[model samples]
Target: MKKIKTNVLRLLDQQHINYETREYEYDDNHLSGEHIVHQVDLEADEIYKTLVLHDHHEYLVCCIPVMEEIDLKKLAKASGHKSVEMLHQKDLLSLTGYMRGGCSPIGMKKKFPTYFQEDILLLDRVAISAGKRGLQVILKPQDLIQYVNGQCVDVIR
Candidate 1:
């Protein structure tokens, strides 16, 4: 496997955040977060999916379990907006510098308000993307929240 230097890894290292990298075979058809949990040999509850959402005017980042779905009404309440929608897939790369399946909450073109499913705090460690398909960064959930200034909210259904 070739080494991939992702911005997410750099930021974590700079902050002295302890983490482990888990890489699996890349397959678009089998790369959902649920599948990643199995591929990486981790629990589904400990792996998360990063979603970019828009309330029409601004974007917010939401992290939820791969096996769960975000309730838009809850997301709207969390964002203090009337409605919340997932950002268009077409706009992902240009706006956040991440492709659809490889978006990590940590290293983006700019920082936006971020939210994590409150359930993350229950786990000692959580697995997120390494800013690339087929790679995961496993680290303390507390470290991630502190590093990203993320809010913990109950927006997942």
Candidate 2:
């Protein structure tokens, strides 16, 4: 199978950021919290998913552990917005150039403000979407913060 061009990888290369990529069989509709854990052979808590949300006026990106759900109110306050609502799938696609299952914190069409759960920093390494289904990137938390200019906050409940 041909490799999908991921902005994450491109950005990493452009900035000389180090990362490791792993690929599995493409599943197309594999966005469930459990699938990623199995694919990466890691505990559910060690993997994270990115959610694209809009506070009506601006877009924000929230990264939280796969095992947890984001508290919209908390996320909104953390992002400095009055309210937070999930972005539609179409909007997510148009804005990030990635489907729901493949949204990466790095390399988006635009740099939306990013909030990451503070607990994620405790992990030595974590797995995040590599811009496509069946693809994942393993990197250190610090590397991700530096690469994406993410703010560590209590965005998850």
Candidate 3:
């Protein structure tokens, strides 16, 4: 099957961002980032998962390493909201034009404010979903932060 050119990949190409795309077998058993670690043969620290959250007022994008848990309270404060809630699974496609497990921080229907764990900057490169299953995009953390205009804050535990 031909690989799909997801919006995330196209956006990076359009902006001339340096990145590497890796494809893996699509299987429900290997869907989680932890399982993906073995499939990609990369450490958990080198993979970031995209999460969409709503701070009561607006939707926000949160990226965290696969093993890390999001500290919702800190995220809310960092985003200047009283509280933040994970978007319902049913709302994922409508709110962000992304299906569950295929969201990318690079290209969304609406440019929701995005934030990442501060520790991501310490890593040289990280892998994120390429807006599609079976596709992974690897890029420098700093480059992703700049391209997405994402804030690096302490939002993960």
Ranking of all predicted structures according to TM-score, beginning with the best and ending with the worst: 1, 3, 2
Q: Compared with the true structure, what per-residue lDDT tens digits does model 2 show for residues 1-157?
A: 6766577888777877677877756665765787667766777777889999997889989899987999999988888889989999878888988887888888888998888999988998888888887788888889898778899998776
Candidate with the greatest TM-score versus the true structure: 1
Which TM-score value belongs to model 1?
0.96
Better of 1 and 3 by TM-score: 1
Candidate 3 residue-wise lDDT, 51-77, digit = tens: 999966789999999888999999999
The lDDT of each candidate is: 0.90, 0.83, 0.88
Candidate 3, superposed: residue stretches over 4 Å from native? 1-3
lDDT-based ranking? 1, 3, 2
- Candidate closer to the true structure by TM-score (higher is better), 2 or 3: 3
**TM-score of candidate 3 against the unseen true structure:** 0.94
Error of 3 at 3 (Å): 4.8
The digit string of per-residue lDDT tens for model 1 on 61-86 reads: 99998899999999889878899899
